[model samples]
Target: MCWINKIESIFNSTRCSEEDKVRFAVFMLKSNALYWWNVESVAQPNVLQTMSWEEFVIRFKTQFYPRTAVRQMEEDFLKMEQGNRSVRDYTEKFIEYSQFVEHYVSSESRKVKRYILGLKPSIREFVIAMDPATFSLAVNVVEVTERNKNRQGEEKVVEKRKWEGSSANFRSSASFRRPKFIKSDNYSSKQPPARTCPRCQQVQQETVNPNRKDVTDAERQVIYQGISLYLKGVFNAIHLIIFGRTTHN
Candidate 1:
């Protein structure tokens, strides 16, 4: 009976199906002892040489198997997000298996991520309303909200004003501070009349219109409006194009 069992074992080992072989390969990788010498590559050279039929099967569920699976998962995730591929249409397929992938980006895979962008009010309200988190998850979420209160406020204000209208307020900060690069004394000139204005030749019109002496207050208003609209349109067009290119890229 012992002799027969040994013969049967040898026969079964050689006759293992390809699925069993691959599964065995996965198992062998999981054993750090099995991979003691070589791990730079995913392949299991030691398994081919020393593993018995049963030991290989045991190794498949050990620590190293997931790493191999993750590598394969990463390749699949990259192909899904290229330009021609619509993110919504194909992203679902990748998302279902993304957790299996190795080293996928936090924003992409989302298993372990530092929240760079805080959730919007609408999203937060929805998450809180829906299946409330398990106790631990709830506590962590509250902690995150507390820590990011200032950042969240900034994000909300930015979103609220980004496109409703142009944000015209200048940000005055230390970034705007100048140390008087070329110092000038605060003194006034006493003399004038190097060149007389071609139109307003009598009164001092150094900063005013030289070619329109008879221009009335109403005409000035019209000119200012036209110039303001033209400048606004130009600046708006330039900023719009810059934003569009940056977003698309």
Candidate 2:
């Protein structure tokens, strides 16, 4: 198949005669190909001498390329879809496979319609609306559509990231500026003064009793003053520690 394509390219470029094309192709055949040609020539004597380039191609393909493979190729081409392939890749395969099914894409309109039908639904809808008259035009329209679709997807992603970033910043700022309790120096003054326990009063009465001879009056008075001062200091310290600020009144 590759050799035949090369020969066709040479003929197109050099404007070679049909006889010359056939002769060149036959000369290039080697090994098993050459052996096959020899056997063919024997089976049908002087067949090459009168054969045109087209006739020679048909005979060559009949010998090398089987009918079953050609039929399978045609069937696959008819059922071809873009699926996950990119527009350009699908287009290339479509062209390659179309060669085996010439009748399916014989006209430009037929080829364009077939190509459009095989495209992804999103692209196909727009292309059908445009109604391209040529196969090339249809391909161009779909390629542009695919590019625009991809660009839109990228923009949406960028926009989503920007929104998420701003939300994160807002959350962080709100946390940083949150209000906290303020300590005041006069907080203790708002509450009533601490009360002395009944037990302390009873002890004081016992210490100052007239019958008791453990201490003199002046010494009892001094001890009573000391106990009262100690209790006052303890209550004041507890209030200051718990409230963070306090005032003496």
After superposition, the stretches of candidate 1 with alpha carbons farther than 4 Å from their true spots are 1-69, 102-249
Q: Over the stretch 120-168, how does candidate 2's per-residue lDDT look in tens digits?
A: 9999999999999999989999999999999999999999999999988
- TM-score, cand. 2 vs. native: 0.65
**Residue pairs in clash, model 1:** 27-59, 27-60
Which number leads on lDDT? 2
- Per-candidate local distance difference test: 0.48, 0.82
- How do all models score by TM-score? 0.17, 0.65
Cα distance off (Å), candidate 2, residue 171: 2.2
Worst 10 residues of 1 by lDDT: 109-118
* Residue 230, candidate 1: alpha-carbon lDDT: 90
